[model samples]
Target: MTKKLIYNGTVLTMNPDRSVYKPGYVYIEHDTIREVGEWPQDGSKQALLESASWVHDAEGKVIVPGLVNTHTHLFQTFIRGVSDDMPLAQWLRQIIWPSSLAMEAEDFYLAALIGCIENLKSGATYIMDHHYVHTYPENDDGVLRAMEESGIRGCMARGGVDLSYEPKLRETEEEIFANTDKLLDQWDGAASGRIEIAMGPLNLYGCSRAFLEHAAKYSERRQLISHIHVAETSDQIENTKARFGLRNLELLEAVGLLGPKTQVVHGVWLDDGELESIARAKASVVHCPVSNMYLASGVARVPDMLKLGINVALGTDGPGSNNCQDNLEVLKFTACLHKVNQLDSTLLPPMEVLQLATVNGARAMGRERDLGSLEPGKKADVVVVDLRKAHISPVHRASSALVYNANGNDVDTVLVNGQVVVEHGACTLVDEQEIIRRAQARVDRLRAKLAPEYPVFRVVE
Candidate 1:
């Protein structure tokens, strides 16, 4: 097996017991870490030659487990910043759906690729993409190809939303099931261990009970996680209550969708009982703090969720909602916003926030054993951030600096499964500029071609 050594850095394992920052050297073999310690020492030269391939000097940079994005719509990269200030319903009904409907398979491929590239460069090694806009069968193939090309580890959910205010957005039950099955068959395990597929049954208010139950069963029989949107907005909560006569989490539990392998995205309006149910079920929650604030969809009770023993992961949501796919910003916003919202600076402590972005996120994605920490036997999913920045000066505590002060721009290098995906703040596997150019061209064409058809939102500049 191939091996590599990364030494001379401060390592944060993100493990519950050994989560604190400590200086160390890590040795990796193949895709798994072999050994790690506070200092490097000479080993048997013959054994080293037989296994080790290369060695990297980290130069005292801070090494942390790569960030995990629990929820994202990679195909929405083209709509980033288009309707930044709109509410959740307005953003979805007006700007997002129209643009998404206009997007072709090629456009989606480019956009997903761009999203993956940007994510890796920003220190996110794994992303759980709730990729919902598959207008055609070919679109699924294109999205999978883009994920393969980026070399990032992710679970791509073939998202299906069967109800919308617009009739065109609604789909027949047969169509949704067929598409989800086709997507799963096509790309479930396409990239050796890097890419996997899951079922993303849009949201509670958008999907029927039959659809949710079917999707949950399908995922269970296939041994895959059930990815779904829960309690995202106040209106959705109200609608769920009105129609089902139960709250959102209660609806999910009644539908038999809440369990150990379930991941609920954007749970911004859950009540106390719902929170307890989530913890008891051992399910996960994706906290999109910036997106929630952007859409006025109430801040998630993440600090409380943690207290109740729920796994709270970080997410950027979709570009249409968050306007940017940056986990660094998610870390910062979650740490600061929750503390202020709860009026307790002690509420999401620095180390806890860091865990949400790292280990908690990995757990939410069902990849904690392999990808969450800088420990021996874990996957070499790692990120190196420059600690010598002006904003990060006089670092009293590494964890505090990481959650409160560090930005995506500080991520200088990223490695996924021991392969360098992003170096010097740029992706190594794809042409970043070419990806951006094609993405912009697709956006421009879609806007120009569909401008006249859209009445609620202007598609043109």
Candidate 2:
């Protein structure tokens, strides 16, 4: 029996009561947390330290539930900052579409490796990657291989767009299902169940009704989540309404897709009725604050969604849109962006924002019972953030320091399933420098393949 102990840290349980144990300790047996509370009253600490196989003194650090990222696209790591300052529509056509055609199988593997490392360094132990680009037959497989190698908890939302203008990016309903089935057969619940599969139909404009219905039925039958982008921009809302009489969520409902396991990404232009619809269906809406602001895609009604009893979670989106895969960065953005949007200082306090990333994110992934809190019997996915640093010190509130001040660099350690995958802010399973080098080579090669007019090749004056 492998036993591990992380003691002398400030523990944010993220439980229903929002418990915090200053100078607390957590005991893990195998892959589950066996005990976690304020330094115990019993004289078992010394005995535990002596008996545990691994021990880490977490003094001057804050231990948090591993951040859950409900949405992202790992394939974008190669083309992030290159396509900047463009709206969603133009960004898709000029950057993502062109890059999709240029990317090869190896490119997907390298992108997922670096993207997973970035998320680990950022204290994101659980990620729902909405990876949709499937230009090559082995592209998704390479991504799955990287996910397995990274040793982080992940859900690869295999994305398909049957209605895209870009032929290379489009897949027929049969192709989407066949590919999804193949991936599920090979990778679902692989890596000791750290990896999962989800059906990701791109969006209203990108997928046909027949395609969506097939995806919904397949995912529902398998008890997997159906993740999709919806109402991200005003133009999408108008376009979908024009093409189909119903709005994005309305169409999803018509196709029997709106349910508890549906993850609706970027509900930016949703109306009150639509918000209520999501709440009634018990579906989750992921808020990607940085991406929304980056694309000038208006802020999602996160606060209102929370008020309507909808499960609202946080995501960094794809790096192509967010420019980085740092979920911790999303935490700060979510707190500040919504407060400014609502013009209310008292709204979305630090603890509440933390919930959006932790517990709410777990709920979004249907793993709330096993993955969200530091409670006993939960998965031992924890992060230790060094709070003794310059920007985080004086030991105010752990939650405040985390959401308002702490960046990804503040993360000192990350553990997934009781395994120390990142120690001292570096990935343990793979050579970090090597991953970055390979990804850059792939990006350089990809850029060579794309036209000069693409944002990546445009030389800034």
Candidate 3:
């Protein structure tokens, strides 16, 4: 393994002690960390230095474990600002569903590529994309190829639904299964551990019990996470209760789908019993605070869940709901929103909030052993923020500033598995100008074709 040294930086570590605000150095050996902190100049350290293939100056940057986005629709990066000012159900029915139905394979690839660039530049090293818009099997391969080309780690969930956003979205179960099988076979473990495939049933209301069972069985056999949308809204919960005679989480549990590998998104309306169920099942939740606030969905009892020892991670959801795919914004919003909601300034402190974005997210996606922290034998997934600036200067507390004040524009560099993917606020894998042009053009065409009555596209320059 090649060795690299990153010297003269403040390492956040996010270790067990929640260590913060310390000047330290890091040693990287290929995909794993060798050592961190200002160590003694001993003989063993000399030997490690002699083995180094390269060295880089961190130059007073703030080093944190790469952010993890546990739930996102990367393909929806093109839909930013489209379905604003609506309830979740209405947003899905009137705008999101129609736009997705109009998407083609090229559109999926371009959108996913741009989403990857946005995520990496914002310091998120890993993404769990709940891809639900594949109209055909070929698009699945297209999306995974885009993820590979962008050079980010991802968990791709093949979104399946027996029903559609409207009567128009209904595909035969055969079609769903065919595309799903194709997705799992092609995208699972693609790109040498940079990408993974999982079962993404759109939501409980849209899928039949049999489909849920099949997804659970397949996920278990493969030891993959079963990602789904559950209890995101009160209406959905009520509808599920009225139809299935149980709440959404209860329905999922009754169908034998609640387990360690299950990851549910939003979960704004999960009751105490459901929280207990999640705690007992060792399942995880992806909390999209910005999206939930945007849609006016109730605040997900996140503090309660945290107190119950349930694993909760941060996600931006999608551009349509979040209006942007910035993990830095997610971190800041998550940290402050909960404190305000609970009427206590101590709700989610900087250390705990940072953990939600990194280690907790890795645990949710079943990649905790490999991708969460700057520890030995873990992947060299890391991000550097320029803390010399005025906003982050006078660093009394690294976690406090990172979680409360820092933004995506402050991210100076990002690395995935020891490779530099984003540098100086731009992606190394794809051309930024070309991506913007193609994204704008695709959004225009889609608007013209699907929502002509809305307006011609007017993207801000």
Q: What is candidate 3's TM-score against the reference? A: 0.94
- What tens-digit string does per-residue lDDT give for candidate 1 at 1-461? 77887667777777768654356767788788887766534543335434567766666478888999888888888888766678878787778878888888788889889888878877899998887765676877787788888989988887776665446567777787787677677677777778788878888988888878887788788878888889988898889888879888999999888999989888888999999999999999989998888888898888788889999889988887887887887888988888889888878777878888888888888888787888888988989887778989778777778887888888888888888788778888899998788778888788787667765335545
| TM-score per model over all chains | 0.94, 0.98, 0.94
Backbone-clash count (model 1): 0
After superposition, which runs of candidate 3 have C-alpha atoms over 4 Å from their true positions?
39-51, 451-461
lDDT of 3 by residue, 341-446 (tens): 8899978888888899999998998888877777767888889988777877887777777887788888988888888788777888789889889888987888
Q: What TM-score does prediction 2 earn?
A: 0.98
Show pairs that collide, candidate 2. Answer: none
Off by over 4 Å in 1: 19-22, 40-52, 453-461
Error of 2 at 98 (Å): 0.8
lDDT of each: 0.81, 0.89, 0.83
lDDT string, candidate 2, 185-204, tens digits: 99998999999999888888
Where does candidate 2 stray beyond 4 Å? 40-44, 451-461
The candidate that wins on lDDT is 2
